[model samples]
Target chain A: MTTNHNQIPITYLRPAKGLATLNLKDLWDYRELIYFLTWRDLKVRYKQTVLGFSWVILQPVINMVVFTVLFGQLLKVPTDGIPYPIFSFAALLPWLYFAGSLTRSSTTLVGSANLISKVFFPRMAIPIAGVLSGIVDFVVSLIVLVGMMLFYKIIPTWNLLMLPIFLFLAMLTALGFGLWLSALNVRFRDINHLVPFIIEIWKYATPVIYGATLIPERFRFLLGLNPMTGVVEGFRWAILGSKYVENFDPGPLFIVSITITLVILISGVIFFRNTERTFADII
Target chain B: MTDIAIHVDKLSKKYKLGAMYERQDTLRDFLTSMVRSPFQKRPVSDNQILWALKDISFDIERGSVIGIVGRNGAGKSTLLKVLSRVTDPTSGIGEIRGRVGSLLEVGTGFHPELTGRENIYLNGAILGMKRTEIEKKFDEIVDFSEVAKFIDTPVKRYSSGMYLRLAFAVAAHLEPDILVVDEVLAVGDAEFQRKCLGKMSDVAEQGRTVLFVSHNMSAILRLTTETLVMEKGRIVKRAPSNEAVDFYLSSGFVETGERIWDVDEIPENAAPFSPKALRIINEQGLVVNTIRSTEEMTIEFEYQLDASVTGLRVGFYLMSARGEFIFTTFDTDEPQMYDRFSVREPGLYYSRCKIPADTFNEGRFVVGINASTYRIRRYFQDERAITFNIDPAGAPGMQWPEQRLGPTRPRLNWEIEKK
Candidate 1:
């Protein structure tokens, strides 16, 4: 936008001599492409399906209902003070957003092989677009969480203002792992099946179905190692308020999770940039 | 400002070939190969490393259109890929000034699920156009594609021709400082192909640099100022369009008696049928270019059918210098051979036939080849493939000969007794 010239010059391309070259300027120039790709993805997501955008709301609601019947009713998992459905839905919302985006982002490179081999663009745009497209589903599913809260007639405290921070943290956690999975998937497609398995296992470890205290106090920190663990708990605490979640504080877990998330996210980006040059050749 | 729009220097790309490492594309293949690698020993020479491009360099002045002509696997696509940055070079570097739009294939990212209107915007963005730019040209693109009536429909339902029309239309409207186009014209029907060629020529006339790669020599002759001929991973000659086309066509046919097919030149579709070599042997059993008109000659066609092919037939077409068809003969034309080999099993086979003395009339003759099954499929056919010079000065009728006009000069015996 700031350029005086009509056309941008495409400079030399060669084998990297030292560190991986990240064409931040090209990415910036093509930022609109990312938006369009994300927009295209959002539109195509719901096309031709009878359910359409309802699937966005339906996915979390269906899983939450299943969890409530199994964990909240059949076994009667202790839920501190708040109702089980609201508690479960709050956690499930962020968990699904994180899981869905991660799964989609991991395969984005291989999925867009046609684009990668033919046109010149910032390769990072593809997975980033994939991760960004999940925002629509995230916002849509958030409405269901609010409806559940009204159904339970629960009034939130001032801690509700902190929900945005938890949402940002969940996005960070999702994008961090999404970057890693998507790049790895380009080479070792075994990562494709592995991503779903990890997400499935990660859901249980993150306390999405049951409350956070379900983990024994000694091993609770171990759960925080999975970044989504702190995110899910942070969501529950922010939505249900501090008093509702007993026997645990989400503050320390959030710190640990955020640190791990940033570490993974940075390394994921580095690895992706490193392996991107070989994608067209190998894929 | 420098006038050079593109400069590639000492560029090279090496590819390792082997079944084991030939693009272990799938993770399953990688895992299985990993599991099997330590057990079986692989010879060091088993994997042949080929340099797709070798220290090649070229430059294009601004506002000039250049064509690259090459045999398949001669590194034309590799050079384009390197220029497009789809894959990194092994060693050298290439500098491209100004905005470079590359169409490696038509419709790089057109999702079939998206409607035509949405796909245009998506494809424009994929080619690095901004929203405002695409919006400015949106109507022009729609009109040029001539699919405005069906613009709202998903492209998957459109006939393939319509799909290509929309795809090529988007590419044509992409206004870049430099354009790189490959064999995208091969996809569209003839009329659409002409439309694409016209659009490319229009772009060229706008004083933008263009790099075109195609097998259509007529298109090259009409559009390009200069052409680069590549052979064996190197640019052998760069000249004006006519000279380069002449060099490409005539250089490989100088050796008349035998023609050897390189492993890389054989097409993949010619799968079960691979032609290895073809030669003509004189009466003395030596392969030679010139043959006496009265001497018997043998035409030998050597090829391999790796897999059993039912109804496999090998044939040759003999033609005159001006492409006049003299005769077409097939190996299976013999009545007795009908049941002798119904299905060709996996093996190397040679089809050779002897021509009696004085079978050819004079000058030079050409031999074309056809390898296929009757009414089933045609694997490979090359018309006017190779030519050989024939000498008739020493024939039986040489004393009274001026010029004979026919495919064969048969020397028939006549009694001089009064009848």
Candidate 2:
């Protein structure tokens, strides 16, 4: 059967608005590649290691201990009257996944330099696989966090059912910023050296170790300006069943953060797609 | 209507060299520049930006095979990349109707740590093939590449030949409407190259479009129905295969910078001690012209005398461009030797060995010049010294149909016996 090129519906095959000519349908057709790449990243990262799957648990577990000592004992930071270890571990769950995924995904373009220079695929797949692969580690880390809660007799409230929503929001945030930095890293070599420093400063901006309650009541809304502040506090609220402090609700704040993350994710993708055409020549 | 699989409309690519767009003035710089703009107006130098390709256009029918012939850096690969969607053109547009499989480099997209089986699927995905489609053709591709036993092994364990064999096998098996190949035939041995050429010919015969870029003129002439000759990023000639190749070869004049052969660098297989540099020169020692059969030529050799030697034999042999040895002559074999050679004059040995007229035939012949320590173990044999084209005054009487009888137009005395 012959198909008329003119008569075909444009929306069925055209690039979503704002992109010059990125074929989202073609990316969908190659979705299996995305799955395989994500699987390969997960397999290769932990293969033949001494700890094997334990390292996934060990990462956030160790971070939670160090943070509990530093932020709880030495600094005497209040944890909303709960034990400090549980409070820090809950927030560290989503933050660890976001941080780990961000570090790997920001270097995705550089680490896959061989692949990008030689092969032809949707270049988006590299960073996408990187960020998605962290889900496996995030899940493994979540089990340990749940075990810690049981050890402390801290029951997860019904708000735990909303955990997946918060988890997805955190992943989208990592992916949005990861894609922007990876593309920029290819042109400006200095980005490779700046990644660790950026992650260090960003952690302070987000309440990974201390509770979000430490922010003064007046400035609490401004603290949610960093997208991960909502994710960290959202994880604690979902698991610890906590309330927004000082009538400064996280509902509008979380909505604004999600909106901001979505904008970054979409625009980051368009910017990456435009710059991808020049990657092979300049890369 | 006959299907037109590919279309081009005013396609062009421009490249800028040595020009960087400066960052906009920072806040500090903006304050500083506000006081300076009225006093100082600086003109910028126009950095030499070159358009490697300009206003070039062509269309390929659904099943037509086209050959793109050009020298190094003539923008052939850039054109293929643009067509394959590896890069975008600076201006203009190209349209394609079906999936495009491009082999820009053999084994380029293969990952080293992945097994051959995994890479077969990964590379297929990279080239836009579905996993199920690659699975369907998996056994066929493995058998064709002859790497079936090693399919489970990582590609880093495979030899270079094995890697290229499997990579080309995957590219060849990809069932796409158009196949874009860029000089990939040079990856394999001569026999395998012939097989690949035959496979591509069969693919074209099966009503698929092929865009081939190669330096091998004979293969280009044999495989393509239509050919385009490019020089300095412009299509200088477009015609049938034979006429295009003939025009391209003749376009290289003996004088000026229009020579076809790249004589600047030594060839990959050139001689060790023949010359740091050598070229055909006239009696006055200006690099005058290519040798025509009617002219008596001087075979000039410029070499460095590394050590003292009593009998050094310097010579040259004629060969086809394909490295087939035709004939040889040596200075010692002619009983001409400079005895008691010591460090009399070190550095840059210049010897003008004269070639007598009427001793050669017309066609392309490579100069295999060599220098040996009297009778050393053939180790000092320099296989390629230089390659020169030989053209004669008049056309020798010969029938066109017997072209492959031999490479040379030699005059041999013949006799017939009747029983």
TM-score of each: 0.80, 0.76
Scanning candidate 1 chain B in windows of ten residues, the lowest lDDT window is: B16-25
Off by over 4 Å in 1: A1-10, B19-21, B25-47, B253-419
Q: List model 1 lDDT by residue over B30-61, tens digit each.
A: 56777889577545472377788998898898
Each model's lDDT comes to: 0.81, 0.71
Question: Candidate 2's residue-wise lDDT over A143-228, tens digit each?
Answer: 88778778887776788898899999999999999989888776656667888888899999988777666788777777667889
The docking category that best describes candidate 1 is: medium
Screening candidate 2 with a backbone cut-off below 3 angstroms (N, C-alpha, C), the clashing residue pairs are none
In candidate 1, residue B66 scores what lDDT?
Answer: 96
Binned by DockQ into CAPRI classes (incorrect, acceptable, medium, high), candidate 2 is incorrect
lDDT string for model 1 (A1-283, tens) is 2434446566786875567856577678889999998998899889999999899998988888898899889989888866788878888888878877887788877889777866767788888887789888988788887777788877787888887777777777777777777777777778877988898887777787777687789888898888888888888888887667666888888889889989988887787788888777666
